[model samples]
Target: MAYAIRPFRKHDAAALADLTLAAIRSLGAERYSDEQVAAWASRHGTADRFVVRAATGDAIFVASDADDRPVAYALVGMRGKEVGHVDMLYCHPDHARKGLADELLAQVEHHCRAHKVTRLFTEASELARGPFERAGYTVTHRRDFAIPHEGREVAIHNYAMEKPLT
Candidate 1:
C-alpha cells in the first residue's frame, strides 16, 4: 500500500518515539551492537522533545500506513540559509525495505528545492547510508558519537553524507 505523507502533528509524538526505537533496534544490527542501538534510541529524551522539534521545523514529514499509523518520518531543515540537513529518518521495522524511506526522502528533497537549498547533508546510520548513496549523496567521512546509556557513555558510528542540490 502507498503511504500518506503529512506534516507532523502533536499527537504523533508518542507514536514517533515508539517507531524510532523499533526501527533502530531491529535495523541497526548490521552496523551496530544491540547496546549501541539502545543508546541511540534513548537519546530521544522524551516524546515531548520530538513534538517540540517537529513543530519547530517546516519540513518534518511523517508517512502513515494503511492503518493511519506513522510508519516512517523524515526531517529536512535549514542548517543556515542555504543548506538542508536530514536530521532524522526512520522506518518502522514492520515496514522496512518497503521504500518508505525513499518516499520520505523525496519529500525532504522537495522542501529543499522549494526553499532554494543548494546542498543537503546528514549523518546517516548504517542502514540509511545505502538509500542516501543511491540517491546521490556522498560520504564525506565516518564519525563516532557517544551517547549516555544506562549509567555510562556508549559510542555509535555513522557516515557524514552530503548531496549537492544545485
Candidate 2:
C-alpha cells in the first residue's frame, strides 16, 4: 500500500484524534491498565485542541492513505534554536510495521535539522522505546508517574530519550 506524508491540515484534527485513541487502546493496552489507557487516550478525543495544535509552529506530520485520510502522525515541538521534542507519535494498528512511523521519524529529524535544532528528545512509552533506540536515541532515564484522571490517579512509566543531531 502506498502512503503519503504531508503537513497536517486543520481538517485532519478529528482523524488524528480517532487514530490516537485507537493506537493507544490497542497497542498500549498490553502494558497499561484500562484506567490508565483511558486517561491517556481520552485527551486525544479533544478535537478542537488537536486542530489548534496543528496550526501551531510545531512540525506536525501526518501519514495518509490513498484516500488522503491520516493513518499515522507525529508531533514535534521546538523549544529554541537547538532543542526539539518529539511529543507524540502514533500509528493505527492496521498501519503498524508498514514503515509509516519510520518515515515520520525521519521527517521529524529532517524538519528539526532544517530549523537548527541539534538535540532531539522524546519521552517514549514502553512500546516506543525499541524503535526510538533503533533510530539512534539513547535512554537518559525512565520515570514512573501518575496522571490524575477522572478523580483518580493512573500510573505510567516511560523513558526519557535523546538523540544528538550534531
> lDDT, candidate 2, residue 24?
94
Candidate 1 lDDT, 55-156, residue by residue in tens: 666467899987788888987766554258888898888888988788888888888888888899999998999888877899999998799889999988
Backbone collision count in every prediction? 0, 0
The most accurate candidate by TM-score is 2
Estimate the Cα RMSD of every predicted model relative to the unseen true structure. Answer: 1.9, 1.7
**Model 2 TM-score (2 dp):** 0.93
**What's the lDDT for candidate 1?**
0.83
Clashing pairs in 2: none
Superposed Cα deviation of residue 45, candidate 2 (Å)? 1.6
